[model samples]
Target: MPQITFLLPDGGTQTLEAGDAPTVMHLAIRHDLPGMPAECGGQLACATCMVDVPEDWRGRVPEASPDERDMIEDRIGSLPEGRRLCCQIAVTPALDGLVVRIPERQG
Candidate 1:
């Protein structure tokens, strides 16, 4: 199992085992993590599941699709170099020990 770590906005940290779920949103929801709302239920339709992939892991992860990028641009207005929608991320073996930061708000 891949170990995924989440750095919450409150300066708290959470780690969990990444199982069969393809997206981080699924893992967050499964574990009842508070930082991610995932309003669109792992769909690219919502930006509420945004997470900041740490610099070291960013290049290892997949890039956002054009539609996901548009949503981030439209909803967030500003995109950080590490910005990512958790719904679009798959929990892969290569992502083991991945660290992510949860934004304060996803609105």
Candidate 2:
């Protein structure tokens, strides 16, 4: 299983072992982590599952799809520099030590 580190809004960190969760949003919802309500579940319709991919990890993770970018940039307005919809990020073995920052609030 891979491991994921969630940087909370309070400046704390939660590291979880990714079991069968398909995406980062699923992991957050499964563990009931704050800052990620994921009201729309894993669907692309909701921007509630936003997370910030640190600069170092940007190269490793795939770029956001066109739909995701449009949702964030056009609909949600300006977010953090590395803002990404966690729903679009697959939980893969290669992301074992992935670290993501949960914004203070979600759209």
lDDT, model 2, position 1:
97
All candidates' lDDT scores? 0.87, 0.89
Worst 10 residues of 1 by lDDT: 34-43
Against the true structure, candidate 2 reaches a TM-score of: 0.94
Q: lDDT score of model 2?
A: 0.89
lDDT of 1 by residue, 57-92 (tens): 888999888888888889979777889899899888
Candidate 2 residue-wise lDDT, 1-107, digit = tens: 99999999899899999999999989988998988888788788878888999999999998998899888876567755789999999999999999999989786
Error of 2 at 77 (Å): 1.4
Clashing residue pairs in candidate 1 are none
The candidate that achieves the highest lDDT relative to the unseen native structure: 2
